[model samples]
Target: MFLLKTLTILVAIVVIIGAVTLASKKAVHHDGLEIEDLNKRYRMMANAVKQAVMKKEAWKKEAKAEKIRAKGDDRSDTKPIAFVIDFKGDLKASAAASLREEVSTVLEVARPDDKVVVRLENYGGVVHEHGLAASQLSRVRER
Candidate 1:
């Protein structure tokens, strides 16, 4: 029993050390979603909502309008853009790096009329880490 307990404790220590080492490493990535793709998704959702609210007979006329809208002809001027970023924060706010990258990308291409929306989920952990995350978000506003 003594030997078994010793081995278990050793294994646990090793696992904890490995986790800490990995957590200390910096890992950041950035990915941008195309405006066209977002528009497609918005149209799909709008279609679903329209289908739910309107009678089937009304669909034909709406569908024609949808086609024109889909063709990108409803506007004579530039349409405003929206940039969306998602961040999931943990005890260390490890996602802050990715958030920084995403914000940088948006700032590079976003116009004055463009908007940035960050969908954030945080466990509300260490003060320093959360502050870092908040600073990352503030970059968007500063731009």
Candidate 2:
């Protein structure tokens, strides 16, 4: 009976540890903003510029010119977009998975004129890890 009780205790401990381990594991997070959102942000900035110009009485006439410039002559065409991704590599290059997912997401909606910029920081680590990171970046170039 003592042996059975010990085994039951051991199983219970193992189950508790397993549950804690799973709970502690971090989930990967990925997010991106669309170009249209960026354009809206730019428009807001332009409006702010107009507001500043209005405050300066001397620049009142220039305010109209500024507004016309801010509206941009190219309004008839879609502005080219750029997607930026930042990666910090460790010895395991675990960020490669996230990079791949982000790149794939961007590619789905990216136009031929769009750009992808990956800002990477690495102190150099395992060869395979770096290679995997490079491969992930190459996928961006392929698109």
Candidate 3:
């Protein structure tokens, strides 16, 4: 009887911890932005492609990439900066909170000509969660 009681208590404890973990996972994460240089990444990828291909083909690819890279790099006063943000939404849309922060951060530094690019990956999810996620994104235009 004592052993059975102890096992029951342990099971209860485990259940409580599991519930708390799930709740926290679904909660809004306050972690800040993860910034990356798209242009630098592109340059790195271009170099990789150039190295993989034959010399002549690599030159051709590099030439094309160079043109694209130049256009990206030569930012005049009037030219806009592209703020690219990637969001992978789960069923709970827990990432919506972080995305809100990202949009706000971009908006803070945004110029008149600046634009935002959100690469969202959401197959399907709870209706309310999706709606919340969409609202968070719409904040960009509303502001």
Candidate 4:
């Protein structure tokens, strides 16, 4: 019981400090977020790491990657898009409304080959809330 109380106090202090820090550092201008090309980011990071390798091995690795890329790219077709959405949930599942909107938008443009990727971060919650959240996802398949 004493240890629990101490932990609770420490957590409360951390929460207070975190809230203050976030309030002070919050974005003043709410310009929209940029869409990053993850594939490009991976390629750039790989190239940077390759530059640090021993010279002969780096050349060999680069050649192998290039060969695989060339073989994969020898097609004249559109690339399938992966739409990624994040869901941070609570007991009440308040975020489901926003999730519904995101799913609707993705469904509008999503082709059969395109993908809707959801990164769910919900600790187990009330049954009804989970059901609601699940139905929103079902809309994606219903389309």
52-113: candidate 4 lDDT, tens digit per residue: 77597777888688779968975454778888888999988877777877787778888888
lDDT of each: 0.81, 0.76, 0.82, 0.80
TM-score result, candidate 2: 0.53
| CA RMSD of each candidate after superposition | 9.0, 10.1, 8.6, 9.8
Pairs that collide in candidate 1 are none
Deviation (Å) of 86 in candidate 2: 1.1
Q: Candidate 1, residues 69-142: lDDT per residue as tens digits? A: 66886653478877888888898777777777778888998888889898888887788878877897888888
TM-scores of the candidates in the order shown: 0.63, 0.53, 0.59, 0.59
**Candidate that would win on TM-score:** 1
**Model 4, residue pairs in steric clash:** none
Tens digit of per-residue lDDT, candidate 3, span 1-143: 99999999999999999999999989966566777888789978967787677597768777887778778985567877888899998877777777777887898998877888889898777888788778878877776
The 10-residue segment of model 1 with minimum total lDDT is 26-35
CA lDDT of 29 in candidate 4? 47
Q: What is the lDDT of residue 9 in candidate 1?
A: 100
Q: Clash number for model 4?
A: 0
Q: What TM-score does prediction 4 earn?
A: 0.59
In order, how many clashes per candidate? Answer: 0, 0, 0, 0
Per-residue accuracy of model 2 over 1-143 as CA lDDT, tens digit each: 99999999999999999988887774533355333466668867976777676667645766677668867866543777777777888877777767777777888988888898887887777888778778877877887
Off by over 4 Å in 4: 1-34, 54-77
Q: Comparing candidate 1 with candidate 3, which one achieves the higher lDDT?
A: 3
